[model samples]
Target chain A: MNVNQVVQSIREKVAEGISEVYFVACGGSLVDMYPSKYFLDSEAKKLVAGLYTANEFVHALPKRLGAQSVVIVCSHGGNTPESVAAAQTAKEHGAHTIGLTHNKEAALLNYSDYSFLYEWGDDSNVKNNPMAIILDLAVQLLHVVEGYAHVEAFQKGLESINGIINQGKKQVAPRARVFADKYRNEELYYILTSGASYGHAYGFAICSLMEMQWLNAAAIHSGEYFHGPFEVTDKETPFILMMNEGRTRALDERAQTFLNQYAEKVEVIDAKELGIGTIADEVVEFFNPVLFYSIICVYREALAEVRNHPLETRRYMGKVAY
Target chain B: MNVNQVVQSIREKVAEGISEVYFVACGGSLVDMYPSKYFLDSEAKKLVAGLYTANEFVHALPKRLGAQSVVIVCSHGGNTPESVAAAQTAKEHGAHTIGLTHNKEAALLNYSDYSFLYEWGDDSNVKNNPMAIILDLAVQLLHVVEGYAHVEAFQKGLESINGIINQGKKQVAPRARVFADKYRNEELYYILTSGASYGHAYGFAICSLMEMQWLNAAAIHSGEYFHGPFEVTDKETPFILMMNEGRTRALDERAQTFLNQYAEKVEVIDAKELGIGTIADEVVEFFNPVLFYSIICVYREALAEVRNHPLETRRYMGKVAY
Candidate 1:
């Protein structure tokens, strides 16, 4: 089913008395939940939202998770143990569990009250990707339940996201190649961003750079950069700053101005220059992650090619068991 | 004022109508706010809580901030600009503002509806530290507003914390020295923990290690270890694992087991062994940050002694303008 159809079905089921929405997942999937959670937190009048790692959510279950709650759990492959367990726990509490995954037959589906299958390998259906779908759900839910006014603009923005992402990929290619070449031998890189773009930067740092490329990387919030992490800035240090056109853009720009002066290498990926400027300013921030995901994928691909390491290459992730 | 008295004042002022709580701060102070926010998130049935860096809090003000909201802003020295702005914004929104600081005369106080001064140089008053004070406020508010049952036990535990910390300091000295010696020359270190202890680990990595010592470090959540970070672990990797005896202890243990096998230098600081076990099991996790804070201060001091790099020696923090 399309994302709107999925949201329509969800709206028809638990739209009356829902008070809480939980975005629970793990790893990259957990990061993917951030934008939607951020959206709800910023816009929802009566709905309280939470974003949690599935394991922590299971261990420290919120006291309010009952029939009034709608818990959304996401796993890329639909088989993350913690995600499955979180769904089951939410189910036991009588909260409606919405499971999102790329796989058709997922364990999460069995425990979920509703399941949405997102496109995995299909580039043509960029809007059907897990992050995009979850975000669409959040937008639709907010609009349906609380009369969020920007729903139409959000959907229109999403419709143009594929084109925006394609343009972003092309626009970022030259810089991505340059960054890969320049930082090819560097042992550590810090990925910094704020607001909605933070999650994508986190995914890029951990999943793409550290896990896939075997490079030391950390994702730092731009707003939190001045607090303590800024002390690490020096002539030898390198940084990747993800800039988004959003309410927290000033935070990113502040960090950027500092990084340009202190850090020798600062690779910036600005959403405004990546076609996000064409989007309605009100709803553009919500799409920052989608655009960022595409741009960073280009970066990781370039880095992988330059480093002669495939993105799937792993040493201990699946080969050895703890 | 004494913590309970401060909480009493807070309870009397806005306790009747509070529906949302925002914990706003920066750097180590931001980490300090995590425990209370976590406590509220786990225990409070009606109050929605948010933990944010002060800048983000100011920039993306929650739409729910109003007369029914309580904003807790903390700045150790009481002059963090973003924190002051957050307090001001909260006041503008007609939210009840509670400012926590060590300084008696602070800008934050001007914007706050109520203010609590914590002890900075007074080691005898550990219970009046910012984290302890905010946590006490949370506990009392929970009890007064929602009738949280463990308030007395939490207070008793707070009274015993000073002695527990002193004992923990002596107990951890030998291991701290060993860890400092083993990783004295290391260029990069990763601090890992889960649940309530994660914030303390984050403080140790960014504030104590990176900001103070000018070392490269990243704090990884133990629950997130297997996700992408574990791939960076190998025989040469050095790690400082902060383990707390909490609901998420299993997550920390799982990461510790993997780190012990794959990483050469795994420095484990167990709260259970650090006198946290003496506290009531029901309230132990809430105090993990307090225990971990003292233990890591020992680790950082030992590191500074071994490296002959004074913790106050900063190249850019306050010496140069960003």
Candidate 2:
């Protein structure tokens, strides 16, 4: 079934009452689920939503998880042990479980009530990527259960996201190349963003920069920048700022203004310049994360080339028993 | 009234209903409130709790912050503009608002339905510190509204906490001095902890290390270590691991084992060795944060002395426009 039809089926089964939705996974998979949680938190007035690391979710299983809860678990290959255990725990607690992965024969699929396959490494099928599919599940559930008015706009967004991502990657390639050359020798980086766009900066910082390149990086939330993190900003500090074109845009702009004044090396990446304007205004923010993620992938590739370090190089992951 | 009586009064006033509680502040104040949120999430079966940065709380106010909500705002000197604005926003939404600060004349007190003062710079009155008082509010409310059985033990903990903290400082002083000497030249550090103890590591990393000393640091959650972050762990990496004696202790231990195997400069400060054992086992976890926070203050002070950098030194915090 399609993402919408699978969500519709779950909605029909839980028609009597549904109070909560949980998104749980690890690393990039956990980061991919944030936009869906952000969408639900922003749109649903009554439904509760939570995003957690898979092990934390399993260790502290919410008392509210029951027949009225929908737990969404994801792993790219559907082989993360903690994520599989979380799905099994959710099932044991009688919560409806939905699993997203590229592998159909994985243990996560066996434990979940509904399994949805998303495309992996397929540039032509961006809509079927894990991030897009999980977000669609949220969009569909909110539309069916809580009467979302932007369903049409959201659907249009899904249809045109691949073209928008391609445009974004092409537009940002020159800047990405410059970033790679300039910061090639730098040891640490700080990626800043906020709201629905936070996960993209986070996944790129951890998965691409830290894990792949063996460099130090941290994702600093733009809204929280003025609090304590801004003190670390100076003329030599390297910062990558992700700006959104939504309600939290003012927060991002405020941080941008500060960074421009105090820091010399600030890379400003904005969703408005990435063809999100082609999408309907009502649902543009929901598409911002995928655009940011796709363009940042180009940045990662550029860095990998300049540093002579492959994106898949690992020191501990899958190499040692960590 | 005392902290317990203030909470009791709020409980009586909101006898009709209270479904959610939000803890909002900035910097160290925000970090200080996480244990209370963690306590509510771990103990309460029906009460919903959220911890957010003050600006985010004001900008993206939760839809559930209405008549059936309790919003708690904290600022050390009570002059943080965002936190005061959050209290006003909560009041405008008809929620029961509680404000904690050291200043009774602050604007936060004016906007809040109830104001409680916590002692500052008074080691003799450690029980009345901001973290302890805010946590007491949660404990008292839970006992009154939801019938917590650990009330007596929790009260005993509050009474004896100051003594425990003094003893803890004495116990960890030598280790703190050694840490200062070893990392006096280091420019970046990562503080790691999990569960209720997470706030201590976070507050220390941001407020003390970054904001005060102008060093770069990030608080890494221990449960999330195995995902993407463990790749950066090496024999030369400086890590401060805070161990807990709570339900999430196993997660901390797992990370501790990995850090021991891979990292050489790990400083392990545990709750069990710091006199938390004197408190009742049922109520011990809630005190872990305050213990961690207090001892870490010693470490920060030691580092400040050895590095010749005052903890009050800042380039942009209060010197210029944000």
Candidate 3:
């Protein structure tokens, strides 16, 4: 299915659960919950969103589940054991459950109350970007709750999405080129980002470098860097800053100053505003981390191009144990 | 400041606040407040100890700064900005403040109404280890609260410590021997621990690795792990589990089995009952992160030895920031 149809279907499905929503995910499935949590906290404002690791839902946090809760189970392959367990657990506990998956009949779909099949096109055989679709669905859910996002506006938003993707594709070209020029040279690599984009920055940074390139990379809070991490950050071993307009924190200057003292090269994503900040900033500066992440994705894409590496299968991220 | 004499002095001074106690600190200092809190929770059962991030004591926490409240600030350098602010803020509002420090004339000592010096010998030049005297002195203060940390028995316990330290030192000896050791070879390291030992585990596992090794390590709750971070672990990149015998957590073993499927290595510390489970385990467990940290330190020490390098005090791992 094209992105537009995916948008329409997800909106209709999400609108059904305006009161209670639960994100049931394991591993990276949890990261997909970020946008939804942010969307709930921002858009619907009233949409109560909670996270439960698929297995822990039965043991500890499952008690927090209310009858009104709509459990959203996210598994890439729809076969992860804990994801399977979570699906069972939520159903057993009498919660309405939905599944967001790339595969339709991967066992987990059987337990799903409603399931969405994200068609990542040709990339489905390669690195599946269905997790991104999950975010779109969550955003749609939030919009339905807040009366902000609708079929027309969201579709328009989706239409505007392509241009930015193209822009993001080009935006990170220079750094990708520079880093590509220096790829196998460095013995160590580190990435740091804070504010709202941190979880995404940390996750994306890891999966990008380690999953694709098989490099050792670390991510942490930017401010906490001064507490200790800065000592190893020197000219010979520099670090990367997720210098996107990190939500509410305009820490680029302070971070840059400290980084400039040690880093050999400091790259900045000068995209105007990429983060989906608090509801207040959403009206003003809602685009920082997303665009910045897209830049990183583009950089990763470019690196794949230069290295003659095939695109990574989502399966390359390994699997979740039950 | 021999360990024995130093231990005695700190014990005598902390007794000055036996009626009611409040442990105040920020950052790691706030973390060190755990044992005292646990002690009050279990033994003193009557003393009512509250551990607050010192700065909050003046505002939301310490409305009653009367002499009844004994605020013990555990700071490595004894001069954290917030801790200092909290000390001043507490003293201005009439709370009796105590400073625990290695440096004699620290700013925190100036603000403290009572000061206990943990002078661990001439540890100034060597950034490697603290003077044993001070650590023992800090241990002594625990006795004053409820007269439970029997000095005579603990002195014997101190003798056994050398053996445990040797075990730790020996366990990590091989870790440093390779640039590509099993632990450091990974793209990420996550340390998880709980109960009384959480704060130290959190600090040492997360902070120490970042400070000394520049590795991306995430340290969090053992129980909390299943809720979110557990989803990310696969057989290739798994988490390090800190296992100790205390609370009956059926969930931990289940979580471990899941992680074992995907983990590169599952490092375990058997901090089980030694008959001293009540006090020593609580304190040692509360400081278990430090114990585990001490192991990491030796691991790095071995690494430095094998690599013909020195323990790079990149960020002064123990240095407090004011």
Candidate 4:
């Protein structure tokens, strides 16, 4: 199946599997999976946890699957050994399964009761990961728990974000240029965000900092920064705070004012308002990382280029065996 | 009044007024308060969360607390303007207040209907924050939870930790001599630990790196590291792993072994078991940051001295608000 069709299919599967979920993914796939899960979890009535990696799964054995459990596995390449083993272990313990994958080596399709392919093996621009679309489809599917109107609205939000991402490519790189110059001698950054967008900020900060800038970075909820990271904020600290276009306006206003109090150098990325036609904040929540953070990747890329560092290839994060 | 008696007084005053709790505190006081609330939440009890800081209390508004809420404020100095303001805000909202402070103008005490203080005041240190004990006392009084044995053990553990910190001073500087030389050029670090100790690691790493080393740092649960940070692990990466005795030995073992696989250099500090008459790991959890991370500070100090850079100071994390 082509990526678009597979993306549509995963959403249907997630909607079907909403009653019982056991997410098992690692590295970049796990990081990419959070946007969908964040939406599912905020609205979900069932149990959910994002496991760290496949190797760590053996430790959680006594909490094994029953007839109700459904394991969902995501791996970009399907070559990582432990993720494969983890899926196998879940099956051995008697759980139904679904696999989302692009890699041929993935044993996930073999082990899973149902599977969706995110790659049609077409000549695609490697930069735009279709897997993100598939991931959102899963979130869109499970959002049916809240009912169909919500799910349909959520899909349209994803499409709106896809449009934004396309438009952002021309403008993002240059806006991020100043940051590239200043952070040359800098080695760490902190990002503090909130609610559904929190995971998006969290994912982008870590992944972009690691892959694009080769810099160590951290992210926390805006409230949590006050709890701990606030004490350390000083003139030299680099901080980025995300602001929502709607829904979180008060929180956004407070966080921006509060964060600016401590950080010497601060950057605020405010989400552009969509004029609220049909894509409400809730439906569009999963796309914040795409809409808000891809612009950040431009800065990150600019920073790397100025430093003469290639977009550091991530050989470790998505090499999944499952 | 004694800590328990003061707690009883607060509960009585609060019973006549508010029923819900929203705790606000910092430093050792917050640390002690967290455990009971954590345990209570784990036990599936319904109680509003302790915001952990006055700064946070004003911003997050944490679930449900209003006219009939109880604001529990703990601060040794009581003078921190924000803490004082938080208690005042809650009182303005018609809340009952409980102050656990070492001094009256320590701000919190002035606004409370009831207050708790230790017989010892200025003499208290991180190892003996009167505010911590009093907060613990308040939790027990309010919850009617009995764990006198655990209290006795923890106190004894604290006492032993004091002695170990004293003894450790002699050994740490010498070992630190090696690292201070190497880490001088590094500007970032990532500390990973496990279990409840993970929070401690997160706190201490932030405090120390910002306070003494001047290196920007982040901390995560050791197992949780593989979930996100492991993909970026490499030679020349500044990695510090915590190996204190706690709930999981497997995590520490795995993290250390994996550090060998990916890290250019790894620093391991074996903490002394806390309390007398206990095995090393048994007591290790009590005051592990002091035990294991003292070497890190020493290393930083050695670097500052050798490199002629000023030692990083506790500009904001220490006793004074300035």
Candidate 5:
């Protein structure tokens, strides 16, 4: 997987003129693109970016996605029907489409104008992680349009991603073990976070917990928790809080304070406590989600082990005709 | 409330070359702004629109939110600390701030550049509904910016909202009662929808079920459900589907077909069956969410009654110090 070549090809499209960028994918892929979407929205100088589930993208066919649009489709298997269809739709709308997958022969590659095949892995290794690749692509696009300096810091942070993941695994093991044991019998759990880590909270809740383990879980943004979800808190209620080193840390701190007062079973996965600060000071906010994802992956595995549910176990996901 | 006057004041601000619009609120109020946010993004020709939870809005402080920004803040009680702080922050950033609330004497009014007070009630009557008011305001801004014809169709539909509400109530009651009876003892539920009605599913699950009724529920977008949440469905799992007459109807239909094959406890609230078509044909997509909200409100009431709970009963929301 030549990332530079992929970035160069996307840069050429940007040179031609792309007024907007759409990150289109399904499920885990959609979740993978979210951090990139947030990064592009905040960093891109001239391009407007939006995130959409592949099916909805095909249905709504956003008015802004036209000749000057750049659509990025992501699928680990590269054969997700909705994603392939979304790429086809983007082409029909005269948008430049790019597909990112681990399988070169996947169906999504057939429709994308440009396709990049990377490596997929088990729970341990972090190389060529889909989320990291998407984030890097987003930053590279901004680097092409905006400037190299603005993204230089992020690029530097990306260099240490493998180390960060290893560190996260080490730091999260004990906590994950404790949490898995403590809440083994709990039928439902709420995962809470804010800002850059919100996407991880959402993705982990739905993909890892609900889909993979068939556990009942909901992810609530810390900022929105006080609004209504706080009502669910009680002396025995269980919550997992992902505290990131970002602008919205105060929101998570606020939630932590409240949860501490009411809930006895509260698990906190603070990026700072996990030594995220040692990676890079300036770009820590952008990397917090990546760290959180790495940690939660370990947490998921631990929970799966304790609950006697394999992470790959699924009743209906790809086995059925849905 | 004089909606026309509110329109007039916002129109004058639009004439001053508004660059962006921020719909800032929290909880149910945040959910109320989603349809408006969608409308603004799709309809506002020259203006950019973004939705942010109140705390996140203040924390992120988007670079685009300056003198040319129009920030609309909503708080049912008009005293929500985060919302009030968001409005104050918007004002400090030189953006034109508007606050919508049920109490004129509330603290939000003090920081808002303009304020509108409307009647609030128990979940039955749709008259002056918070979501409706916000949608109307968003359409009014679009009307001011890009001629009147596109919005006139929506305005016409708005006039018949009360009738639509009445129709929805009658149509959903029997199904709501049946669903409430069948799922009364279920420990958790999954609510699914797409497009405009997505917000209703989200709001109903959080505000009505989690907050008011103290039930566990998660809202999943129909388009995204197949990606991950489909794994949770079985012969015994309970799900509430909001099928709307909109562009995303096919997505919901697809989910319905899948759920029907696997889940025995699927309760669907279809807007087409609710007579949303007879009232207005041209803008039924825009009215679909309002219709769904109304129907779900009745469903929530039915569920509350069957579960021996009251809608206004809160364990911590307004009673806690968080």
Candidate 6:
């Protein structure tokens, strides 16, 4: 993929004075865009970023989404009805729309001004991760809009992501096996994280556990955990805390301390502990979600193996007419 | 509470050139601010509003939050530590800070440039609802900044909130009792809603069910429900559907159809069924959450009574040191 070509196209639109960027998608794809949205909010000086569920985007029809807006819609199969509708709605409102998906022939492409396709197969591989693609788009936009200084570091981190995933796979396999064996019969679990990792926690809980494995789960941000969620914690309550190297580390640490004091079935995945292959300190926070995602994939595989359930096992997703 | 006085105070700040509005809070208060934040995003022509968890706001302080910013912090007790810290941080950054709480002597007041107290007791009254207060602030800010035209309709709805709540309570009581009796032993539930009602579903699931009653629940937005959450639903899944009068009603209707076909334990509270007390149709969506909250309070009471679990039962919060 030519990153510069994509960046230059967005730059032309930015030069025309865009006010905001909207990342619209559904489910895992929506979760995939959150870290990118976070980066845009944190780094962009000229444009603001908003994350919206595709169906809600069509119904809510944000007032700011007009000629001076950029909307990016993501769907792995590109056939998600709400996502296609959102892209069409955004285009109808005169906003520049971009579609990112693995299916080149997806209907979403027909409505988008620009469409990019990544390679994916029946096997779930990390090479075509939507999160990485969205993050690249966000960095490029920020680079052109605000002369973002950390583009080089971001690229370097992206290049090292595969190596980080490989290392994480090796380190997490045994731990994941143990955890899966211990909690395979558990009915519900809570995944906790803060900052960029929160997105991964949410995606894993809903997409991997709830959807794929048919388990019950909820993802709570550490910053909001003490407020009400902490009341649900007990000695046997299962929780997985993704502690990443970010500004919100203290918030996670505070929650971890309390959880450790009470919950016996607590699992911690610290990004610093699972090294990210010699990435720069300044960019670690920006890349924490990527690292967490890689680690979580390995954990998911181990859990699937132990529970005798394949990661692709789904009872209602594509089976019923919901 | 004089809404006009509050509006005038916020207007003076608007005249001073505010750039963005930050809604900062934790858990229930944070959920309460979501609808107001949505209104600010949708209606405020010249201003942007960002929602942040209190601790995250203090740590990842947005670059836009200096000098020309307005930060609104909400805490029912007026003594939440993270909320107090967030107010102080915003004030230190030269942002105009406002604190909304029910306690006048709460420490958050010391760090706020302006503070408003409401009367909230064990009765769960709508008069002092934080959501109503925050919505008023958002509308007033838009009124002064962008000459918003919906201020009158919004105020009319606010004036009729108590009546709406009373009518909703009366209609929801027997149904709530029946549903509670049916599912009091259920371990987990999924509350689904869309658009404006999404915030109330989330707040009720977390605050009233998870925190107050120590129940396992997850609130999924109808827009994103089909993406993954639908896979977790079966013939016996306990789910609550909040069907309110709004643009997103179609979204909720779709989900209700699916749930009714598949899930046996489905309880729906349709706001349109229980009227909003003569409010204008244009502004009814804005008041749906308030009506849902009132109905849910009665549902909580009914559930609490059936299970012999009082609303105030606490195991961890405010009981033991973290």
The candidate maximizing lDDT is 1
Candidate 2: segments with Cα more than 4 A from true spot: A122-124, A280-282, B4-16, B122-124, B143-145
Q: How many clashes does each candidate structure show, in the order listed?
A: 0, 0, 17, 11, 0, 0
| Segments of candidate 3 deviating more than 4 angstroms | A1-22, A38-49, A52-59, A121-162, A273-280, A283-287, A313-322, B1-202, B213-267, B270-322
Docking class of 6: medium
Which of candidates 1 and 3 is the stronger one according to TM-score?
1
CAPRI accuracy category, model 3: incorrect
DockQ of each: 0.76, 0.60, 0.10, 0.15, 0.64, 0.71
**3 or 4, greater by DockQ:** 4
Which is the leading candidate under DockQ?
Answer: 1
Q: Give me the TM-scores of chain B across the candidates.
A: 0.96, 0.97, 0.71, 0.72, 0.94, 0.95
Greater TM-score among 1 and 2 belongs to: 1
Give the per-residue lDDT of model 3 (tens digit) for B29-109. Answer: 555556445434434422444555443343333333455455667667776665777777766756666677767868888
Order of candidates by TM-score, top first?
Answer: 1, 6, 2, 5, 4, 3
Best by TM-score: 1
- Provide the lowest-lDDT 10-residue window in model 4 chain B: B39-48
Candidate 4 clashes: the total is 11
Better of 3 and 6 by TM-score: 6
lDDT of 5 by residue, B47-97 (tens): 567788999888877665777777899998899998999999999988888
Candidate 2 clashes between residue pairs 3 or more apart in a chain or in different chains: none
Residue-wise lDDT of candidate 6 within A115-187, one digit each (tens)? 7786553244443577887888888877776677888988888888767767777898899989888888887
| Residue-wise C-alpha lDDT for candidate 6, range B1-322, written one tens digit per residue | 3655755765675556666889999999999888888887666656788899999888777766777788999998999999999999999988888899988899999998887787674465575678888888888877766777777888888888888778778888889999899998987888899887787787887889889988888888887888887888888789999997877888899999998888899999888888863777666777888888878888889999999999999998899986
For model 1, how does the per-residue alpha-carbon lDDT over A86-173 read when each residue is reduced to its tens digit? Answer: 9999999998888998888889999988888877652755788888888988887777677888888888998999998887788888
Interface RMSD of each: 1.1, 1.6, 8.8, 5.8, 1.7, 1.3
Candidate 6, residue A33: Cα displacement in angstroms equals 0.4
Residue A79 in model 3: shift from native, Å? 1.9
List candidate 5 segments past 4 Å from native: A1-17, A43-46, A122-127, A146-149, A279-282, B1-16, B43-46, B122-127, B146-149, B279-282
